[model samples]
Target: MIFTGRGRTRFLDAVTDFETAVRERDGDRAQRAMQQIQRHFGDAEDDQLAQVGPRLAALLPEVPPGPRGMVAVLIGACVERGADAAVCAPYVFDGLAEALGVAGEFCERWAATGGGDFPAPDPDAADGDVLERVGQDAADGWFTLPQWEMASVAMLNRPAVRTALEPALRTGLLDALRAVQEASGHDFKCLRYALVVLDDEPLLALHRPTGTGYLLRMTGIGDNFQLHTLLADVLIGGGHVPGQAPSAQEAAVCRNAPGQVPTTGAFNLVTPGGEWVWNEGTPTDIPVVDDVRLLVLDPPPYKRGWPAGRFFPGMPGDLVLERVLGADETREWLERCAPPK
Candidate 1:
């Protein structure tokens, strides 16, 4: 008991010192105090989990960006599988229900089970024929739609966002990020965003490329959904790793398409939001590009719209402007560009 009291007093003192350091903007002192606190606190008896939990919580409020990236990737996978609003909605609902250990009986009853009249053969059909026929017969007075409509109940869940809508949404989102970078002094490729889902809440985290700071928000998925939602959210928000800083030679513009005016050809542009763009603007002119490009494109901006390629704003719908040449053509181009031994 005496040890416990001493531990508590030390923990509180360390916290007070850390907070004071923060108020003073003393990074070094704050870090030292934090390290000291951790050295004593990490090994605290599990019995004190309740009291220490809330006190330590304030130290790191921002969610990490790595998990957010993972969620975005998972959402991308679900979208690729042709998951529509309805299917995705149910899947997310089921996942959340399973996590919370609270099943919706009505929802379960209406859900398609293998033993139901409409089975795998008609999986492609929307809601299968069972619900459709039920709707049709209601108009003829042979049946009546339920007072508690499935769609009405569905509204409560908000469904998983539509997969078809994601690519376009993500594209615009990238543009927003790029625009942010154009106005900042930092390298855009050094920043990234991630969406995370926690039990009952959904959140997002913007990670700086240096991994020093993170911007986190409670967006809905983290507070209301399963941890899987967190995974899905991360899969959806992608990121770019920082590459070697450019040298004066690397910043020099190479020739663009033959007929282009005598502007500084094309050097690599690292935006403030952590994306790379071809320095297509004139060298003397103030370059204004969006920061969101990091989430949309890959290392070399000239590459096609592959899974890892960068996105630009030319297309009205899709994020990709056009597909680049095949593997053979790419190989040949690289070989030609390679410097002589």
Candidate 2:
């Protein structure tokens, strides 16, 4: 199960390549490096995979904030493919959990005990409805919620925000609801939603009260995928409840919300011509186009690949969008808009 010095060197080289590609915003090269890293782990014996936890933990601090999620994905893939409960508990799961500054005890217990079931839901409980409904919707293959409401919930439910304010109400229901209202910032309140009822365009909306409101429109496909996962996590009780921010060391390596970055207020706008606008707030007066390729309203900031200030040779929004929309079209659009380089 022990990794040979040579094997370790190869793995580290792959990680370095992956990190470099990410920094350079080379999508194809980054993807190739990731696949190589996956193959390296895929070749490992289960016990050797168990040894990977500390190695990953060691590497985590070295990884810049931008690519830490990719590292998490690599680790998760390795564990899912090879590591067992015993192998995962102390090494992989606990290490990641601790780094995130959230309680790892639940995950550690589940891994050690080989329990796959999430916490049991209480139907009679008022506080359980959001989780229960979200879980059911996900299982049913349809998750629908008012976009603004969902954004509010996700922002308020963020671990850092929750930890900062201790509401007087002990009931989870009131506390979460209060958090939602309080978390809805001034800009969000100025917005209004007009639901598009077309069978072909479920979840489509025209937001209003500003010329820039059309930017809030959602694609039924791209957006729902992100929302479904976020909601399902809350339902399953996977995230940490609010508490004091993690220590500097923990926050440095923690993937959850390092530096407690505000999760609300950012919007992603995609034009029919493939131009993307990533704005900190709603942009006004965008001209109507043939078709809007995509619009993600108030996407959780942490999910957007690291905070703004932490990374070098910053990855462009176009490159990030290319990961979602593919390279050929993205490149074509960029070429059309190309400035002297």
Candidate 3:
């Protein structure tokens, strides 16, 4: 997705060409346009893909059958990239099972594969049974297929829908996980944490993720005091301050040291030597001084939770070791996926 200056204009024009070709049913022109899409945005940032992929999927009906596969690819890519799949067109899921290379026989494929992870749903049990399940995070995969797609996964009551989506769901997930691991040099599960470096703050957050960050967010450290935890009372302090925000403290243990909130929702965690590691599988086990350990709130991928009021990217990254906060604006690299180096 490297489009700069005139190249940027060409990309936008290509989008228009694709739409026009779709309306006119010109397969050849549409193919060219689709290639442009993949070329210009195939590796785009999740935020960018979030905008384009679902919109194309929603227009599936107009897309030539030959190019519709790409639309499906786009949708799946959005899912894999941790982009907000919620915005995908409702009908996109209507045929997701077939689009994932199942020859339009999701159920048959599921049966043939011997139910990779789940037994085939009983025809009798699915009779008018509305399955209510909780939504799960996309990065963490799903307890149920389409866990948080906001796509018509709610149609679980329909036996056909449930049966059909399984093949595609499983197939797409595994493929995406493989892609994630290959690009990151680690397992998908390990993608949970970004090795954050306050190297600019000259501090280290190590592999501390959101669960650990929340505790740090609320806990105020003081001089010579050991906060009691179930495990033990760990001594923590920032050079003797009882009434000071993290920003006021020294680089030692100061997370929101910049005292300014990040203006964007995208953020990347980096290494102490200043390298992006959030998605590239960079090692996060490096050790740092206890006092220099920063506890910063972890951010969700992209801006999916914005309407849910999670728009703020937290104030901690303002430490300014690198452009951790503005990561999404520039996609020249792997999200700068590391904190700004």
Candidate 4:
């Protein structure tokens, strides 16, 4: 199952060239790259493709809209040539769900021409049991986050703040959570409450005042259902009571905090050392605060209208940490997480 040597190199080069051609709108170049990609990967055995599944999955996002038909052709060829459905799932199945608006027409054509079909699952089929199982599994192994020593902070879901934070927070949270998992060897099974306050903002803001923990408000143009369900499973294991108010202690923290009134989503992260406030989307030149454990502002993983896939690929390690913690902090975190030399 090893992926290396000239075969891997050739496959990567062909895919990269295909992406480049699509970006440049060079139809001839794209066709050539497509042919080469088919030659290298179209006939690859299931196990061979599975060996490089994650790497292949990483290239899915770069697929351009124009040559999606060609991309479909390549994928169809691979499936026909014995590539496993699991190995091709990320690009073929999940890709259709997530990027359907852009690639739907071509994917349909490919499916009609002997490629696999995309099943439209019943949306309501995702019930409590489904959420619990999937959430627990994901938290246990795949997308777990650290919960120890983490402070909880809930903010009013102001339209402005939600608008600003929506674009970056999902990826940012994912990045930060991954970092925390790497830094601390905890499996984070205790995490039970990542709320997506769509409505009931007034109740949450007035009642549940998370002093300095992970309180999320969903915005942006993507699928809120996917985002909310994913967070609910990881955060509170879907045990949280809807519209529940904050505890007395949490309320005390909110009341004691200065100027903690709800206008639009405005709250400050307070610690024994210092405080940080998120008022709007405008860039702040404030020096990186030591108390701010994690802060990320990357673009959302998929464009608007794309369904959020179950298996979202992570950003590169270096980039993920760099975005939240500056270089110095990232280096320090990495050193602490590094194994003994």
Which candidate leads the pack in lDDT?
Answer: 3
Can you write out model 3's per-residue Cα lDDT over 1-341, one digit (the tens) per residue? 34354555565577779878888888889889978876766445566555665666667767643335446556556654554444453445544333322321333333354434332222222222112221111111221122222223222212233334445554564464444334324332311221111122233232223212111211211110111110011111222112112222223222333232222222334444454333222122322434443322233345421111111112122222221322232232223234543
Q: Using TM-score as the measure, which candidate wins?
A: 3
Error of 1 at 226 (Å): 13
Instruction: Tell me the TM-score of each prediction against the true structure.
Output: 0.20, 0.22, 0.30, 0.23
Model 4, position 212, has a per-residue lDDT of: 14
TM-score of 4: 0.23
Instruction: Estimate, for each residue in 1-341, the C-alpha lDDT of model 1 and write its tens digit.
Output: 78766876676577568667766767777667766666556444444433333333232222122121222222222233232334433333222222111112212332433223322211133253444533322211111111111211221222243222255543543454344334222222311121111112212222222222121222222111111122122222222223332222211211011111121211223333343423322111212223111111122434221111111111011111122234454343333221211
Of the candidates numbered 2 and 3, which has the greater TM-score value? 3
What TM-score quantifies how close candidate 2 is to the native fold? 0.22
Q: In model 3, how large is the Cα lDDT of residue 32? A: 92
User: What's the residue-level lDDT of 288 in candidate 2?
Assistant: 38
The window of 10 residues in a row where model 3 has the poorest summed lDDT is 224-233
* Model 2 misplaced stretches (Cα beyond 4 Å): 1-35, 81-341
Clashes of 2: 2
Candidate 3 residue runs with Cα over 4 Å from true position? 1-3, 42-50, 78-84, 98-341
Local accuracy of candidate 2 as per-residue lDDT tens digits, 1-341:
45555565566577678767766878688778877777675455556655564455445444433344345445544444443323222332222223222112223333344535433212222134333433332211111112222222222222232233233422333333333334222122311110110112212112111111211221211122222222222211222222122233322222222332322222333333334443322222122333433332223334343222111111100101111223454344334332211
Q: Which stretches of candidate 1 lie over 4 Å from their true place?
A: 1-9, 46-341
Compared with the true structure, all predictions reach lDDT values of: 0.29, 0.33, 0.36, 0.33
